[model samples]
Target: MAALLLIATAALLAFRGAYADKVYPAVAVGDVPVGGLPRDAAETRLAERAAALAAQPLRFAAGDRTWTPTLADLGVSLDLEASLGAAYRVGREATAPDRLWSAANLVRNDRAVPFGLRLDLGVLGRWCDGIDAEFGREPRAAALVVEGATVSIEPEVDGIAVDREAVRAAAVAAVAAPSDGVAPLPIVTTPAAIRAADLAGARARVGAALAAPVAVVHEGRRWELAPEDLGRFVAPIVDPARTGADAVTLDLDQPALAAFLSERFAAEIEREPVDALLGWNEGPVVVEEGVDGRAIQAETFAREVTTAFFAPGGTVPVPVEIVKPAVDGTNLDQLGITTLLARGDSNYDGGSFDRDTNVEVGARLLNGTLVPPGGEFSFNGAIGEITADKGYVVSTVVQGERAGRDIGGGICQVSTTVFRAALLAGLPITEWWPHSYRILTYEHDGWGPGYDASILQPEGDPFGGGDLRFANPSDSWLLVESWTTGVHVVVNIYGPDLGYDAQFSETTFDGPFPHEEADLETVNPALPPGTIEQTEWPLDGSEASFTRDVYGPDGELLESRQFFTKFRGRGNVWQVSPDMVGQSPAGG
Candidate 1:
């Protein structure tokens, strides 16, 4: 026994010395045997094995779906030095007797050393996120639905999500044992935040709000909203104050409600304010009182209706806004119209019935017109369009150098009167056009030839018409009062009396030229053949001009302006038959 013990001791010392810088015999790293190999050689062998494993595809299975990805693609690699060191330390790290026993046992049965793996958790997590996005289902919260007068709740749904950590751990295990490269995916279920029980209160509130029809009253008018219509204005919203199942509330869509109210009641509740009409009796007098306008307060009324919708009664008073007129009866004194500044009169006696009717209609339209301070007064704008619909009659009118019959023929009588009033008032005449020829009606009542004003509305163009316009240079509103007596039409201007005296110089005449011979005759299809009827007598042409000097109340001249009038002469207008058309008179 003594001799056998000495031989065993020698063998043990040899074994320890042989493996001092190498792995023990029968030790392996992931099936790659590194036993009795030096540290560098063992590391090289392990690295070669790891490279082969990394190149191989790893299978990941979730249900029937599977993904085959290489270990290197998953950012996984073997720590070669750490694995080799572990393999080398196995038999040498224990007590002497145990170390000897382990070394002897390792020779008979190979021992596997767990691979020290380097895993990129970031990569693994991102890969798992992609899988989750592809196959995961998100939970749906409960909500309220309104259809007509009926209300109900939609149930919540539960969802499934992949367990990313479990997936990562499984991948690591599969990479370590390349022979079994398949990993099973783990899944978890998620519960929704709000369930059907949470929206019960909201559903009930919405149902009650739409249970009955509501009425909105303003003055004597009443508008009704049916239960079905009310449903469109109410909706369910998430309540931030609560959590879990009790976090939902029903609220009214105020804007939608306001729009609904406007559509139903706008025409009846809204109106424009009427300004007070002023007339001169002895001084400035309010002939008619002004009326305040009415408008619907849509938003305010909507809120009130929302509150009333849940109240005991279904009747709610509509909120209204009263709009005051700019010129009211009590504010006449503020208008600064203290006296009559000027009065212009024209004689329309012995005229035809159509001419008399047109002059009366024109004067009535001009009555009670107001010109704001420093604002231009447009005669065409004031009287609007001279149409037959506005009570104008067909009468004689001047077109270019010829007198013809058309609608609104005698309307110039009114424009001429307004021009005389504005001129006498010392107002600035911005636009003025004289008649194409002299008219005895304008030269009536001692007014000379240069005092006429003409206005015409061009066909097919509203703004292209001729207009007599003037500017009020005062600090007060000017009112025009026009009326007609039995034979004479009168127009008067009322405003703050700016003390001004207007002086007119003697009128000068230039020529009495005759009309072109071509214009002497015109073809008339309505007249009989070989017949000639003189429609108008010939009138000689003349140029008339006069200067006016406006003086202030203190005798200081304020303005000096010259007014010029060119009257084109016309030969006799004769309506001849087609056979006699273009024929000159016998004398010529």
Candidate 2:
């Protein structure tokens, strides 16, 4: 009995081992086969075999953070009954087109399993779900690799209909290279060889893109490149080592700078000194002068201008100045020359004078007029020319029909004072005349003296009467002060007040004495007949007198003198005609 039991036990163990081996085919990590067997049955056997070996735990991979399954872990099984049934009728009966049986037959007879089985080794991986191999590494990947490191690419192909051999070959290549660990591949550096084409392109770009000459500005000067100069274009390449910078500065073209500066900054005009403008009193000469018209030692007019605009170190674009003339004048006659106080006597030698009794008579008809130095004085023309429209009370004027006529009578006083003042000043006399007969009050001791009255002919007078005139010879202005109250006429002269006093006395000569009336005739006499309203005794060819004196500022007499003037006898006249002499005196 024991002998029989041992035989059966051995046989059973042997059968089980064989069955396990048959279902599990040898396969690499990545391999595929097309199906000839029933897919479900083939898959079942693969699972069964994989499960039977799964009892042994998977090996640990280096650098793996987790565990992975091996081929034996997934149990696999096969469908024997269907496989056999299909294989027997293969190529023998007219088969339904199924390659399963035909492929099984080949496996059985040729010992080549044409049947395909797919293994589902649930998340199959060497370790940590990654392929455990290496490839394409430098320095022979093995040099740097650790024993258990896996450094290879992993593929994810599933449910593929491919020949098993191709799958095996691909899987071998995928895991073939030795491990190189996690170190990055060393970079192979090699200087790029310069190609002829590359060199030519670089030269072309550099030549075309070079710049024109730079314009340098320094210290208010411009250094320019000469026209058509090739220096900027063909300048020698500076050695970067020597200069430490890319560009070289040609010392600003000094010759060129000097030439340009000469043109722009050259002085163009001479300068003048002083304002060429001077006052009119300074006269026509433009230059400065001494007290006696001598040229003063000073800068020329042009030099003054230069100092004003282009002095040393002056900036360019200097501004120019223009000159103008000046105006000037002064009053000089205002010193103290009284009207009638002349320094000496003045007289008109032999001349008959007419006289009027009216004090309101015009100075032109009463006496004379005066003007101070540089003084411009006017009269009568302003007081109305004899029209009676000027408030002038007409007085007597003798004539044939109008024995006593009235005319511009009393304007004489104004003219008289002016004449005396001008005379005393030694001013040059311009115009003068005398009255026809003697009138008192203008007479000295019953004798008319130095009396010359002007009957200002419309064309002759400058003042209310004929004027006495003068001008300021010095560089000063003349001021005449004139004032007249009802009884007196006053005039004063002021100026640089030339510190000198002057006075005057008058000397006059009378001509012709009076004669008695011999014959009498009447023809409507304008005056009452035989009536005499005597103003003065008519002298009949008698003597007249003249006196002279000089005075100081206080009106004190400096000198006094007397002289006699003889007047010619009056001519005979008759009031009757020759025809009337023959007729009776009263009743003839």
Candidate 3:
């Protein structure tokens, strides 16, 4: 009996020693037996199982639809080392007798070591979210529709929403035991917040607002907006403050209302302020009284109209802003334009019809010009642009050394007349330019050629033009008045006289340098063949100079200035047919 006991103890010792570094018999990891195997071997077996489970596809179902995704796609991974460690420690972690008893009992009852599975809840949740998106439906609220003058309502719709949490929980359970690989999507029905019955009050309000035509009144004039127009100006909007039947309200569209007002009433409500026209008749006189302008206040009108629109229709006054004129009747008397200072005249008789028309138009433009004390007056600024739109006609003008036809040809006659007036008035001349050649009209009435002033406005170059400018040196404002008789044009300056005598010396002439040739010709494609038109006659060049001396009321000399002019000789310029270009005329 003693010899048999020793042999059994040795066998038991060998069994305990073998399993001390390995898993006990009948122990398994997630239904895969790993007992009686070394730690490394157990790890390898569990790793292979993990890989197989990871590649296995799990099914997710919603109604008739199904999606198959692998465990790896759901971020599921098994901890092989932890599973091996848990299986190895199961029967060996207690007292010596208790450990021996547990290890022997494992042979009779098989033990399954729960898998050490790591599931990324975030990944599982997202996968379920994708399924939810495919199955979920959002509810639609009731809406109001408007067409022309009719109003209607659109009904609300109920929806279905998927329960994402239930899907995620099922996915986790399926991953733990990959044999159970199906997850079902859970869903609930939802109702819409706003029903068709809740919009009845709002619909009635909108209908009433569009039932009548509204009027906008200003200064005894009425502008009407019909029922169809009102429908376009008002819309139905949701208001959170009201409950049940008043969940929505009818409101006016501010931008639309303002646009309608501008399109209909802008011309009648807006006007430019008219400045008082000043003229010298005996003393100073107001040719026309100034009138204040009116402008519509768009924002103010919109606010007022909105209030009237909500009140279900009434007449609203149009808001207007008053604009005052620059020179009104109240300030005219303070200008102190009390006497006639000087007058200048020129003759336009025997001139072409276009020239005569231009002279008349130029005189009319400078009729009521008023220059403030010490203000610089520009001829180009006073007459504005010399365009056909301003009544100027095409006439003869000097271009380079020849004559041509262009707009504003006789405008220089007006400038020269005003120049002679400014010279007689003893005003300071800031800018003055002489003509390139002598003109017979400027030398009329015994006035010499050196006394003329010329102005040019080059096309497309506003700043490159020449202007005649002068400064008023008096203590009071100067009023320039002009008019044209059938034969002549006259310009007069009126202001408080400075009591000065302006004296000018006789113009001295030198050298009648004759022109080098008799005939200069150019091609004109527009002229008929064999036609010859003389644009300019030959003239001899000459130099002229004069002196101006201004004496004050006390006979003291105030200013002394000398003026000089040089004119280049020019031959007769002829515009002939293209065949005769570059050839002398018949007699030349």
Candidate 4:
């Protein structure tokens, strides 16, 4: 057993010696360990190789061109000093000794070397076509046939340094896995149609039918745009073909749309008023006459009113026409009459139409007819008479005291004044009457012609009351004016000039020829016999004639008109004392 043991030990020793010979030698002190040598020796060999490689040019072959780049040309090393700078530095300091084991691990760990990437869009140095190139191999054209992509690994010295390669492989597998590509979906707005839209029709149908509707909306303030009436607001809608997406965009002109909607869709409307004035019968005329010498103008009253149109926004007012009043002359017989007669019986009982009262009435008529075509004239309508009620003092009637007591007593004076005015106008007579018994107030003397008077009584015989009526008988109108100046009554007739030649000659017969007893008496008296108050005399008949000739524009006689009058005889009037005989007071 001992012998067998000795031989086996020897065999083991022999195998151990062989193994020790095969193992790498211990690195020198301060020298780094390399895979094949000590760190110091590995650095020396690497430096020699680098120096040789840098001196020569690097060769590169692409499709048809081969390029050699010297270290100087490639700008890799600008100088020998920069290339030789401590090429084997490991850690911080160049003088620090390299740890063999760590250096060996460090060299093995580093995988990437610095390289430049350049893209040549155009051929370098010469022009060429149909080619695009880069500093690295072409990505799309090169058939790599790679079992797997070559990848660099970053080793962790903190852990097992060699195991870091396996970790890098796993990370690369995660990034290289395939992923899906997605394109964004397009969105588009739809287009409007080219046909006319029913905008107005739709708006009208929205409200009540019987109501008055504002149909169209016109221009607006901000922008001058006409609103679409019924058929223009909406347009046809279309979809976008690319994305199968569709939408309608309202292309409303902002202001126009606002106006349209406000008018059409409105719930209520408004209204207003208007007024105007108008004229009648030509116009106001010039009235030269004034009341009591005060100048008065022609004036008339009128009326006016308003009209309106109500619109949606507000009221629009306008003007209308007016109506007026008119004054017309009717019952004109009084205007033309020239004479009147009133008589009292022997009783002195006031039986006749008082001459003064008749005269005043005639005055009123005269003034009215004198109003010119475009002039104004009035009587009470003109100058009003003052009598008992209107405050005129009473007086005995002129020409005849035999007439009974009357208020407007001596107003026959007014009648005479008007009669003269009428004559001056050359008016025509419609009626005329003479005073009874040839009163001296008119005839002045028994031989003088008597003044004509107008009687407005209904009707009477030739010997009774009669009326003289006359017309202006001219193209121009007349304005009659009369007023009492002190005791004289002045009358004026205003009219266009009438070219006339008028003349009158009167022939009177004798009067006071009747012989009668005294039949009338004083109120209180005791006079002796033969108290002759007056004498009654019958008058001789006589005739008087007037000739009126009108001339033309040349002053030649155009017409000769004649007027004739016959005087009748006066009857005998008696006077007597009241206490004497059968006659007490004649009127009583």
Candidate 5:
């Protein structure tokens, strides 16, 4: 009987030795048998079981609705390594005796351990956030506004959403608990951004601003702004970033109100300023009298008017600026103009009426014109273009060897007269050019030979050609006066006494007109083909020169200069028509 008992004990001892290095028999991991296996083998089996369980979609049931979470949709993955380790720990760890007892009991009775699971918390949070995006709603704030005679209020709404952190923790906890791996989003209550009670005072302030009229008074004139018009002028300035009622304030829209005022009274209140005229008494060219002018100050008036429009019956003065003449008689005397510095005259007797007309027009243009000290004078610019509109008639003029007609045929009479006046005044001559051909009118006026300076339209003569120009060399203002009487065109220059004396040489005859005749155009239809008509009698060529010696008040010679001139006679131009003469062009 003792041997029989010993055999039973040996059998149990062999069993314990066989399974000591392995899991006992009849041990299952989540219904999968893994008995009598090593730790690595048990870990492998539980790992496969965990992966299979995780592979199946986790089904969650909440409020009569069921949802299955996909592995990717969950934004998380199960950690089989950690979960398999937990499953492997059951019945495998403890004191040596306890492990031995557990292993021995597993031989007689099967021990089953459920599969464990671990969720990545970071992934769980992201998954919760994604869920909220589709299912969450924010609360709406309340507002009250008064428009016209009616009142309106925007209603309030409650928010329905889940807390991301709470959902994340709950998900991880469910998976870690190693139960049915399911978690529901934890919903929290939310409040509105604003309340209707905060806007109670806004309605009162808006009503007060529109019930009254604004009065504006300027220079015995009173204007009242209507309530409807006033309402458009005042608005509530709101700050978008600020919440609650204090963010809005009732105030005047200054720019809009100012614009409205301008449209109402701009034409009625506006006055144009006129420049004062210089009244001359005698030929000495003295200053007369001047008057001050006034203009509206636009920006300043707008600002003042805007302030008045906001106040209760506020009075705003008319904003204005005292406009003064650019050249007034009071300041004109400061220019130090006192006496006539020089005079030049020319005769236009037995000439065309157009000749008289051009001289008169040019005189009017230059009569009241002023030349500042050291300023250059341009004859063409002073008289502008001598078009027919300016009362100039086409008259006889010279083109090459041909005598023709031009718009300003005799305007050179005025130019030559002013040239002599400028020369005698001892002013600097910047530009001057002689006519293409000798003209008799200059000699007829006692200006003699080289004293002539001629101008033609677009005169292409070399070196500032065709234009008579000069400068006021003195350090004071110089006034030009010109006029025409019967057959005489006169030019006079007045300024502060420059104390200049001028002299000129006697005309030296350069000989009779050059005996040269060329083909010419017959401008006068009366002069037919083969008709050689002599328009100007031959005038002998001559030379002349002048010396200007300007002196100071004490008779000191301030400057000295000699101007020399030479004249080329055109002999006489004979219009031999195109039908008679063989065209042989030539120039002198």
Candidate 6:
């Protein structure tokens, strides 16, 4: 008995030693057995099973069409190392008896080791793409067509879809079992949201309405919308009051109706104010009379048409408001247009070709302009943008004692003449600006020192103001006449003779400042040392002022305005000899 017990003990020890660090007997990976397998051997067996599973194919059917895809192409994979590790641990325990008992149970039944699984849905989706086109259809809903006063209902169709996820799930289960059979792609169906029965009442409401025509008439002009066009305007709808018993009826689309009226009548009824056309054939003549403006009253006309549209005749007369011209041909004589009311004249040295061009161009712009009663005139605006393209030229413009050349330099001559004309006409001088330096040309023609006016585009002027402007205080239109003869240019304002008088007091020059000299030396190598050359003459500086007074038609002083100005002496300019290098300027 002792010998037999030792042999049994040896056999058990051999068995444990042989199977060390390996899966015990009766252990299974899926349906395949891996009993007593080492880590490498178990992994090899699992890999073989994976290969065989990858070789299997699945039959996928959507209606009459069928597609087969291998399990490997569907992203099926197995972790052989993990499966082997689970099998190896089946009989592993801390105590010998517990390990022995676990080994006995493994030998008794084939234990399946649970494992994780993975699939690439992207690959599956690509295979299933477009499969639905053969087995799916979209549902169509009911619709209605509207004639002038009629509506009709259209039918609905059901929808069907080939289920995509269900097919993939079934494929997964088949691939996992390593077997192949026919699998169906589940199909789903649904009814459309709106059916033909829903529009029964709405259709009857539109079909039962009567056809009618409407007429739009204006000033002997008439346009009619017939029944055919009226048909396009009708539509059926759900019961608005929610009574659920009333049939939907045809109604006029008010927006569409209003659009039609605007299209046919808006342009025909709008007119702009026209001024009387004056002509001169030896004397002023009204060649073409001005017409009064007119505007269509859209709201009133629309209301009338809409009200009459439902009535018998359907005739509507257009409504418009008359707008009268401010100064019509009938009042040309009262505006003093037949006679001269005022005149302003000045002279310019036409010796400079470019300077004369600017002067003449600026004067022509002011000619023939008509200023209505209570209207203001802008000298700068009349000349527009002062560019070289406007026929002006680069010439001398003086700021204090500084002088520079500009394209529209001579425009100031025209502005100064206009300013004097405004003063003599007894009109309200709303705005005026004086030059930075007194221009001798302005004083040459019996005008005072403070009479010169200068101008530039708003951006170029430092004072941010216009050079000259005036308001026509007369109750009629005023016409400006301008012309140039030799070096003299004149501006005359013609309007109803207000019989008012204007006068300017003598210019007072009281304050005087002695002239100062400044040396503007230019190097002259040809001259001897200490030698000086005077290039410019200097003048004394002074302040001068004048007053303008205007009387009313009754000879009463209506308003008084004063003009004040100052002149700075142009400091003397001198050129020094280059030979005077070592000499003191004071010594000279």
Ranking by lDDT: 1, 3, 6, 5, 4, 2
The predicted structure with the larger lDDT, 2 or 4, is: 4
CA shift of 527, model 1, Å: 8.9
Residue-wise C-alpha lDDT for candidate 2, range 461-510, written one tens digit per residue: 43455443344432443334344334444544333433324433344444
Each prediction's TM-score versus the true structure: 0.53, 0.27, 0.53, 0.31, 0.44, 0.43
Model 6 misplaced regions, further than 4 Å: 1-338, 398-401, 459-465, 515-540, 572-588
lDDT of 4 by residue, 95-166 (tens): 424433333444356311111112222222121111122322221111111112121112111111112223
Per-prediction count of colliding residue pairs?
Answer: 1, 84, 0, 48, 0, 4
Model 4, runs deviating above 4 Å:
1-369, 372-387, 391-397, 443-448, 456-468, 506-545, 552-581, 584-588
Name the runs in model 2 displaced over 4 angstroms.
1-384, 397-404, 444-448, 458-486, 491-537, 540-588
How far in Å is the alpha carbon of 422 misplaced in model 6? Answer: 1.3
**Model 6 compared with the native: what TM-score?**
0.43
On TM-score, the stronger of 3 and 6 is 3
Worst 10 residues of 3 by lDDT: 579-588
Model 6, position 174: C-alpha lDDT score: 69
C-alpha lDDT (0 to 100) for residue 470 of candidate 1: 89
Q: What are the Cα lDDT values of the candidates?
A: 0.81, 0.33, 0.78, 0.34, 0.63, 0.68
lDDT measured at residue 233 in model 5 versus the true structure, 0 to 100: 54
Residue 370 shift from truth in candidate 2, angstroms = 10
Model 4, C-alpha of 462: deviation from truth (Å)? 20
* Tens-place lDDT digits, model 5, residues 369-408: 5777778788876777777887887776632323567776
lDDT of 1 by residue, 321-421 (tens): 99998788878888888889899888876678888899899999889888888889998888888788999878887423374788887888888999999
Residue-level lDDT of model 3, residues 140-184, one tens digit each, is: 767677677777788988777656555555545665555544566
